[model samples]
Target: MVMDEKGMVMNANSDNLPKDCPQISETVNLIVHAGQKYATKFNGKMFAFDQQQWNVKPCAKINITFINDDQIRHQFMIHGLPGYLYPDGMVHLELYGEGELKASLIVPSQKKTYLVHCELAQHAEKGMKAQLKVGGGDGDLPNISAISSPIKMDAYSIDWTMLKWGGMVILVVVTLIFVSGRWLLFRHFSRRK
Candidate 1:
């Protein structure tokens, strides 16, 4: 039993405590233990343990320190988020070179469920996925067995030339329309004069 700042008795294990008990203004420290052995056989998934899950309130600012205990590289990524609130719609922490990787992020005030997993290959599909309960989660996240197998292919490749050319085409079209409209208006006025 731990006493909150408001002197209220909170059963540390109980999840049904009052929401207004106290504002958890202090920074919360989270440790994500990683290793290659935790990888699942289902396409070499990573972080196989369910104990890797983490949950917290919406307004809390968390400091996550990932300690890599394995010889291989590991990653911590979150998904299914509002991109407007969190850029890239995800938070990626890679521990490829070893040592420890630390990062901090503040959760949005809206209550929602988010997926945390390793994005390397078939990590999330195997067992590297966990549920984060923001402001309270929507029950338990889908288990490793419940997740569909990842498509075995490279999905990150993008055609930079196409993207750049598409943007330039749009810009040129807009500029031409503006210039043509202005030229027509000027010619009409000059003829009337």
Candidate 2:
């Protein structure tokens, strides 16, 4: 882990290889940015990673340059790694504000998708979520902004009873206005006569 006044890179592995993998298959360099502007592409999202998904070969070494475009705390964390190599099975990079940090991690040979997100309260739920897929991934994780459906979707149902009542009320109001206007016109003409 490397720390400075700007940001910190925690549990990044550049050299170490997993037990199932004899050597690194490839090196993937990813430039990921985090901020509100990135979230603008996604409606109702407050924060997000630049990309929603990534795919790499098995045992591929990933070098990530995480850029925080906003002047606030943000993180790029990958979960579901081997705990022996990565303590807590996570590679985390955090920026205190608008800055960038470079880090690396190696994925295992198993075909799986790792969850990448910010640990801040409601950040992932708000949209700072992504997927790192090794070998096309086992499957898609739920609620990966624009990628898959949310685990729990929002329900919006219309009440027919309320609709009927509202329609009747509007019809009555319009009829009363038209009748009153017509009656006033007739009364004016009669008075003039």
Candidate 3:
């Protein structure tokens, strides 16, 4: 038996824990390294190098350390959780620049799967997405390579170019109609005079 910081007796005896429960030795340390690139692309789509996956156990006190290698900014965010587990119903860690960030979160003793990803636009859909499982609930998260991700085309891509062309065509047609209507109105007035 050992006394915790709160002066509570913590018995390490096997009988005190569930039969299949793994021994809770200490707080678990989960390290995540962030950079500006990914290993490979998916289906010719560029993968965003913002988010990554991590596997953890339920009821475990997790200490997450984020190491940013990029020159810009990045974030590590986990979503889809009960409000009681977190102050704002999310686990958010932001790395403003190239440095390290540390945060802790307690996983509830429940069996569930959650989404871990970056909140940047199209980042999650590109490749900045991951999954977290607690209590071994699901079989496993799909392998990063096996997961099919949507392509994140830039705003000036072929699709947007077509859209812009369509808008230009509509604008020209509307302008022509307005100009023809004004000319017809002027002709009618002059004929009346």
Best by lDDT: 2
CA lDDT for candidate 3: 0.59
Record all residue pairs in model 1 with backbone atoms less than 3 Å apart, i.e. clashing: none
User: Tens digits of per-residue lDDT for model 2 on 124-147?
Assistant: 989999999999999999998899
Q: How many clashes does each candidate structure show, in the order listed? A: 0, 0, 0
Across 82-136, the per-residue lDDT of candidate 1 in tens digits comes to 5654556666666654557666666655677788777778666657676677777
- In terms of TM-score, how similar is model 1 to the real structure? 0.54
Ranking, lDDT, top scorer first: 2, 1, 3
Better of 1 and 2 by TM-score: 2
> Mind giving the per-residue lDDT tens digits that candidate 3 earns over 1-193?
2222222111111122222346543467878766646625444434344344455676666677767676655666766555644545577766656777666666666676777765767655556566767775564444343443334545555787788999999999999999999999999999999
- Return the TM-score for each candidate structure: 0.54, 0.80, 0.55
Candidate with the larger lDDT of 1 and 3: 1
| Candidate 2 weakest lDDT stretch, 10 residues | 151-160
Better of 1 and 3 by TM-score: 3
Q: Model 2 residue 95 lDDT?
A: 98
**How far is 69's C-alpha from truth in model 1 (Å)?**
1.4
Q: Which segments of candidate 3 are over 4 A away from where they belong?
A: 1-26, 39-52, 139-193
Candidate 1: worst 10 consecutive residues by lDDT? Answer: 8-17
